[model samples]
Target: MTAVTDQDHTDHTNHTEHADHAGGQGHADAAGDDTGRAEERSENAASEEGTPQDGRSTAAGPDGEDVAEGPEPAAEAALEKSEGEEPEHRAAGGSKKSAAASAGKHAATGPEAPAKDRHARVQADSEGSWDDGLIARRVTEETAAQHVPTAPARPSPPQATAPLAYDGPLRSRLDALRELVGLSRTRLDSRTLAEAGRVLDEAASRRRLSGQHTVVAIAGATGSGKSQLFNTLAGVTISETGVRRPTTAAPIACSWSDGAAGLIDRLGIPGRLRRRPVQSAEAEAQLRGLVLVDLPDHDSAAVQHREQVDRVLALVDAVIWVVDPEKYADAVLHERYLRPMAGHAEVMFVVLNQIDRLPGEATEQVLDDLRRLLDEDGIALGEYGEPGATVLALSALTGDGVGELRESLGQFLAERGAPARRIAADVDAAGWRLRSVYATGQRTGLSEEDRDEFAARLAEAIGATAAGEAAERAWLRNANRACGTPWLRLWRWYQDRLDAPTGRFPARAQVDEEATARQRVEQAVRTLAERASTGLPAPWGQAVREAAVRGAQGLPEALDELAARAGLPPGRPPRPGWWPAAVFAQASMTILQVVGGLWLLGQIIGFMSPNLGVPVLLMVAGIIGGPLVEWSCRMAARGPARRYGQEAERRLREASAGCGRARVLDPVAAELLRYREVREQYGRLMGVPAAR
Candidate 1:
């Protein structure tokens, strides 16, 4: 009996310990499930709120401190109830295994289990001191919340459209340049404008052709190993090398890929002269868009060979100038090609071929020297990340530095911007060359003061002031003729008839002859032209002069006609209101004198009684009164005559000025306006503001 009781007690104790362990394990599993569900719920809520799940919330309290949130009220309530029932759940040893099994099943099945079993397991798990049931409920609620409808996304705002006139920077510039050339055709010199036109044409043709291909011309002087380098770059012996003075007579093209036929054709390369590289993946991939051309020697003795080289160089996208140490600084190459084309440094390459012949360290020295010479030639050196002409040394015969050249070419090809860059550089070069024709030291135009001076000079040439003086004298003479004593007027007429042969009285003011007038007109026009042409470019100044000369051609004849029409009328000068009274008084005085003289004569002849006092007094009075009235009339006519003369002078001056303005000033102004328009267009083309 004692052994049995002891064994039973030991077994019961073991059973209790096993139950406790199982319950503890169940609690741990439940807690883990609750923590996972809580984390899941938190993630869902954070995502819904568009907040980061990095252990912090974007939400802040009113006081600007971060706010920490707890679980939901329903979850807290369920957790409290589970804690309240924990002791009873621990006391119920019989149900402990079932509860642990159920908890395990719920944790494994998650929310995918049947709703009834999940809820029953949650309640049983809640009977322990764990919040697993609350967390599971929260997850379910959050999952359901995901289906709630959200507001539709906001629509994006509309974007502004670009203007049609602004077709990218390069295209717009090209178009503007074309317009500028057209406008400048009449105002500028043909040589510079012609060059600008050629640039426009080339840019248009290049853009229309294959943009994928880059046409690079290998140009050098005679016996400069141009063909050898060309063949090496092409990886095939396409161009024939020879020891002759001029090895390549014609341009030979080698393309690295297909579809370069259009580009090659535009370059004027014949089908027979076109070649392709040997099929290699690496070469094709690196240089697929390259169109290499071996041009004839630029300094060839043969005229046709040099001509061919020049033509091809003008049409190519880029140039590789192959020079040996002997002729790297050749005067002809530097002056003719490099110096003139300094603006094209971005698309230019100066290669020092035949460096193998140089001794140790001479390569670097030659390269440095070549670079210095290029600088003197005005070509920018593209070294160490600067934008300029690329200078490199390589030898085709010894295959030295050829790979580096190839690699550089490959990198250049990869950019696929060679054609555009080349055209842009050409435009820049052409603009620089034509700068002298367009640019000026100061703004030029016709000024009001200049116009007035020109008109004044023209008026003076027509003798307008002299005409007015003559009109004044004519008025005075006519006033005397109208108001003088009749007897004196008769004597003057008789004397005028007698003196007419001597030409004493002038009819009108003398004017210059047609030839003299024309000279004066031209001089005036030239003066105005020179004034307007100040600080203008040569071409524009010449144009202004031509316009002034052209307008002045008909000016002299027009001014003469105007002078004739502007003169006073051929009849008598206008009679004043007091002229009639003066004439009547003079006539009465003459009659008195005649009567007095008759009385005196009769008395003396004894036809009547002698009245000596009355007759003598009457004769003296008549004589004095007639002279006095004539004097008074002459004095009054002076003021009116002067005014009349001034009016005539003003009319002539005004007429002459009008004629000059119409013929000369208007045309010159029109020419100036044209120049301004073209200048504005040039400014746009060059990407600068127009000068005033």
Candidate 2:
């Protein structure tokens, strides 16, 4: 391979342009130079088919042409020197030169460059010593540039020009979470909602930081050799390693390449503790985008060290828990971190470090024991081709099995998706934490039957039926007063006067029943609230009950007002058309009685001749006929009275129902609707369909 210097690159470009002009001229003089062209073609064919004297094989060039593969020693040394000086500088120079050469060649030859000219040009460039390594470096740089991880593109805020379908799954989930937080802040437990909000905020922050680097924290108990492992992977002693109880006091970040400053800052790592790994070309290439963090010992004696460990651990994309055989089963590690983070198995690694201290057979035993312990801690082990937490056994001091750990990390970095996976796990955990507050089964609302029953209860509570009966009785009383015998009517009037001072009228009794009406209304509301809240989660059930109570605060008073207006009308009940005729018949009987009495008096006093039998018959007929008229009128009034009673009952019942619906049922329904909307949003946040 040979490298293309700046001067050579420029000259090559000029030569290609000159060649294009010469080739066009040659085509114009094709017949005149036929023999010479044939000789040139013969030479080109031999160069293509025959092997070179140096015995170098051919490789495909950037434009699909074959060129010599081996590089001159001098050119290869120069390329290595430049790469050592600065890989970025070498990459930049190589890319510019490669692009220029490719563009010149395409312009000179069009789509189908003549084989003879191509061979000739290749031979000339080969003499000038262009190498395969330079081409390879250019290709690598271009590929890396194309595949660099970028922060996820956030969807623009909702606009008329853009539909929601344009947003990604993450955006949709985040929006759902926002809606849930807004709707359920008052309804749900404060702690649960606060946790969900924290998750959302963290997710947003993570997405906004560096996506190119995967920050993996190396955490372990005191004296676990985690710092040793971090140094081994970095190929430098970036973290302090010693026999002391707490070797690392603060978190140290070692990034393999550039473009992770935002993430490091977010992790709160100071500039003094930031580091770059020193590794060979192949190792550096594999781990180009890794940000390895060395955290303070989790089991440190100092509280601040442990707190720092936890704070850094929360922000990192993944974790490598280094454990020695002695403290592998420490209860603090298992109970405090492992069990609680079981859902994060995919982004975790449990490394059995310092394994060289154990004998070969003992090492295998220790590994198996550690696996059992992790299982007990609820951490899923990725074994036998399953995807879960990775388990590794390595000795950082002895360098035993360190290569395997490095290889695994390289594979992890290649995917460049750790940040996304970590955020998704957090979201899943948040949803799980809030699962109890939401019901997975279908939610029921107040049915029409329930509303109808409530209306009936309200009507009963106001004594609407009793009021209707009272109206019928009043109608009958008035009819009696109109058609009764004069003496009996007079006696009834005197009796009503005697009863008036006792406050025992039907209207007065209704006023005393107001307390009972209020009690019934309260009972009706309580029953309806219970029925509405049944089968719902605790928070939602409480919300429903509260809404019912609020709506029913004035329900009793409103129902009473309705009853008063719809019940028996004021003054005497409406008189039937025949009441007047009945009254005249009764008056005629009264007149006949008076005339007979007068004739009897005259006969006794000898003012006129007396007919004692006729006078007695007249008086008896008057009394008997008066009673018959009154009885007939009462019988005739029965149909009208019954109709009046039913009409009053119907009016009061309907008014009571209307009042109940407006005050109680509507408000409860509105509360239920809000709950359903929030529930659906929660379901979307969890990536599931809500039960309707």
Q: Which one is best on TM-score?
A: 2
lDDT (10s digit) by residue, model 2, range 126-160: 32222111211111222222222212112123222
At residue 275, give the lDDT of candidate 1.
Answer: 59
**Compared with the true structure, what per-residue lDDT tens digits does model 1 show for residues 1-692?**
00001111111233334443444444454445453453454455557665543212334421243332222333333333333223223211114433333333333333334333333343333222211011111112222222221121112232232211213877877887888888887666687678788988888777777766788999998889989888677654557777867778788787765456667777777655665444346666778778889998898889998888889889988999999999998999999899988888988888999998999999999999999999998888888899889899998987889888888888888877777777777777777777777766596897788888898899887878878888888888888887788878898899988775321223333444656767788899889999988888888888888888898887877887888888787777788999989989988888888989999999989997998988788888889999899889889999999999999989989999889888888888888888888778777778887887
Local distance difference test, each candidate? 0.69, 0.69
**Per-model TM against the reference:** 0.64, 0.68
Candidate 2 backbone collisions, by pair: 1-70, 1-71, 1-131, 1-132, 2-130, 2-131
How displaced is residue 188 in candidate 2, in Å?
Answer: 3.6
- RMSD in order of candidates: 24.7, 15.2
